[model samples]
Target: MHRAERPVLEVADIFRVHGPAWRQTVQLSLGQLKVMSAIEQCRSAALGGHVLRCSGCSRTEIAYNSCRNRHCPKCQASAAHRWLEARQADLLPGEYYHVVFTLPAVISAIAWYNKAVLYGLLFDIAADTLRTIAADPRHLGAQIGATLVLHTWGSALTHHPHVHGIVSGGGLTSDGERWVACRPGFFLPVRVLSRPFRRRFLEELAALHRRGQLRFFGEYAALADPAVFARWLAPLRVCEWVVYAKRPFAGPEAVLAYLSRYTHRVAISNQRLVALDERGVTFRWKDYRAKGRTRYKTMTLGADEFMRRFLLHVLPSGFHRIRHYGLLANPVRRHNLAKIRGLLHATATGAQAAAANAPPGNLPPRFICRHCGAPMVIIDILQRSAPIRAPPAQRAAA
Candidate 1:
């Protein structure tokens, strides 16, 4: 006989249990609290839902609606799927490179206090670094396109701010009449990319400081002084900044697959939660320093600490986490892509052709029956349940 599978543990479960007690103990921003509330109520009656019946088997079930909060781990999968579907038409028939620009620990600490300004600089500078370097005569010397995604958390849910860029292998010539491609398997040198990225970022950061745009709090409050801030930045100038470029993707499909993993990732996933109990919240994390099988490890953090780390990555409201630059910039993207295809003598791929032939506004149905493999039709609309005014009392004594 087959053994029954255990149900998965989710972040929402932890929030529902411990959040009230934790909230009384520490301060949280409006945005962070909103994220917590959204996670706690996601896909539950709190958000309302619909009743579905299978066309084939007559099976019926109540399907609660997702919170649709971008930061919610449970909500990003469908968001990523929809995003990838839209991006399919933009795929070019060439190599694509994955480049990452990571901020050092010192900067990350400051970023925690001044998120909007600092994180915005990170995105703008990283994209500029790629476009500027790629435009050089010694480098590719072409105007390329890129899609950059900002991920603020490490595997252990630590605040590790970085931008992952998916860049096309080639670009249009100066006159916009020809196509230029990079050498196979190689993009730009990381060492070359790193120095400018560091310099440009620091310069812009200093400018922000001079303009009094950056903020500070707690132990970092001394950074409000220009002299103290200058001294703090001194060490970072000499330290090496990290700019990493992975090998070119095998094909467009591989690029999309890789993007699916990175683009919509949250601080933690539901699958990684191994246990939650008196000891704390236990989860699996990857140690990049370890080799082979040893790299994977499980870690436990006290419920309060775990919630602190999770909330550390809550972004400012209305910040765009994913961005485009150069030829892929939204305004000129379509025109530039048409020009590049013509120069390369390239025809639309089968996927692109199908996308074009598809009827306008024709979207696939979302819900389906698991048992009967048929479309799930909505039979009843369920109004949202009243919001929980307070998280339940702590379950520590249980």
Candidate 2:
């Protein structure tokens, strides 16, 4: 007898069956456990959903609900699209820069343990570094704005923390009266950005350590010693930290398109996932150090190991990975946006400004049926895996 071909696999498939076993071997943090549960249930019938009936063809389909967890691989695209649409108004009619700040190996080790404390510091310090360097008279001497997104995993699912920042190539002058543009082809010097970035991050990290705010576990427990931590950070102080700024973007549209790719990204998208079976979980990963075909490689880890690596990226609860800074800071973004537009005399993007200012629920529905090209009405709603009911004891008592 011949066997039929196997069905294509999904991350959910792998996680659902193997995740529990992996959890048995390790004591996962509440955040990690929650992330695992979300990824496993994402887009499945277990969660509530709605029925969409196409009026044109009289075709009806059941759409499963999204888990909406930031780490869910299946849900980030929609989030990114909505954000890009909103960003239509945030665009400044000038060159924008793609800058990335990476943590060094020594500090990255600490970040692996004390993720919340160190990662938060990284975001703040990186933003402050950009603003401080930009404000110097020797540079643009203007207050810049940035959209910062933190990415905590490497291509192979390792814990490599970094921030990808989208920065305006120009900004408002100190008096907020005029826009100050950088040189046509360049933003601030990477060297200038790197020094302050390294200084500020290290300073804040040390302070956190001194206050015992940082955690060290397993092999890193010795780092809790201030002297040992100081020695570990010493090499980083003099060595050049990685702060790279690409050439200025062609225009604002290109900036938005570029940012949409990075802003809502999770560890690995579904497209990159290849197969999972008795052999293990195999996926494609890019080796940035290599050239051409050699750069692309497939890695297969045992099911348990794969889950462990995936869980490494589970963020602490309520941590905001994407943030606005300086002139783009949430509180002053609108007023400052108006000021910059006034100085530049650029045309408004669309009704985006109005749409953004409108109350959340006041906006119309964003979802529409693809088949009929019409608005989808919720004909029915599904519930979660658990049915809505009291236990037998409660029913008996009543």
Highest-lDDT candidate: 1
CA lDDT, every model vs. true structure: 0.89, 0.82
Flag regions of model 1 displaced more than 4 Å. Answer: 1-7, 387-398
Give one digit per residue, the lDDT tens place, for model 1 in 216-321: 8889999999999999999989999999999999999999999899888899988899999999999999999899999999999999999999999988999889
lDDT of candidate 2 at residue 140, scale 0 to 100: 90
Per model, how many backbone clashes are there?
0, 0
Write one digit per residue (lDDT tens) for candidate 2, span 1-398: 11122237667788888876666677777677777777777767877787876655666777777788888877787788778877877887878898999999778887988888889988999999999989998999999999899999999999899999999988888898889998998998999999989988888888888898988888889888989889887888899999999888888778877877888888887777788889899999999999999999999999898888888888888899999999999999988988888888876766567756767777555445665566656687888784322122224554
Task: Give the C-alpha miss distance for residue 375 in model 1, angstroms.
Answer: 0.8
Report the alpha-carbon TM-score of model 2 versus the true structure: 0.91
The local lDDT score (0 to 100) that residue 316 gets in candidate 2 is 87
**Prediction 2 global C-alpha lDDT:** 0.82
